[model samples]
Target: MAKILVVDDAKFMRMTLKNILTNGEHDVIGEASNGKEAVELYKELAPDLVTMDITMPEMNGMDALNEIVASSDDARVIMCSAMGQQKMVVEAIEQGAKDFIVKPFDEARVLEAVARVLR
Candidate 1:
């Protein structure tokens, strides 16, 4: 089981993700409500994986992803975005996000993405 950090501005999204991951037998090491906090927590926690929201307050996920990757090339981030945010998703991929999950998340998809990245 990989240690994970979940980052999203929405409380429900964060909780839901936590539930899914924990139930899947992965360890959720931390959660953050915004991109800035996500980055800080990533450094402090040094989790094996991160689920990052594309749009967030303070700093955006792309920026955070880039920052994290710059600090640690091995940083594994899976971006979460809405259906219409294709451009942001592409940018996130360019910024070193290992994978992505769409909003209104599907459990299977979420688990698959996490598993793929962890593998």
Candidate 2:
């Protein structure tokens, strides 16, 4: 099972992702409320994957993705975004995000993205 870090400003969103990941048999090693916390947790936890929300307080997912990728060559990040954030999602992909799940998340899609990224 892959160790995953879930990052989102909303507690409910975080919880949803945690449930999905755990049900899929992946271990959620840590969770962060914002990009800054996400960067710190990533350094400490070194999780196999990260599910990052695009918009958040403090810093955004794109920035966090950049930071994690810079710190680790093999960082695997799946960006989470709202329906109309296609521009941001494209930018995230360019910035090294492995994949993306649009909110509100789909359980199968989330699991599929995680599995694909892990592979």
Q: Per-residue error at 68 for model 1, in Å?
A: 0.6
lDDT of 1 by residue, 1-116 (tens): 89999999999999999999998999999999998999899999999999999888899888889989998978999999999999989888987899999989899999999999
Best by TM-score: 2
Clash number by candidate, in order: 0, 0
Total colliding residue pairs, candidate 1: 0
RMSD (Cα, Å) of model 1: 0.6
Model 2 C-alpha lDDT per residue in residues 1-119, reported as the tens digit of each score? 99999999999999999999999999999999999999999999999999999999999888999999999999999999989999999999999999999999999999999999999
Residue 55 accuracy (lDDT) in model 2: 94
Model 1 has an lDDT value of 0.94
Error of 1 at 4 (Å): 0.3
lDDT of each: 0.94, 0.96
lDDT of 1 at 95: 76
RMSD of each: 0.6, 0.5
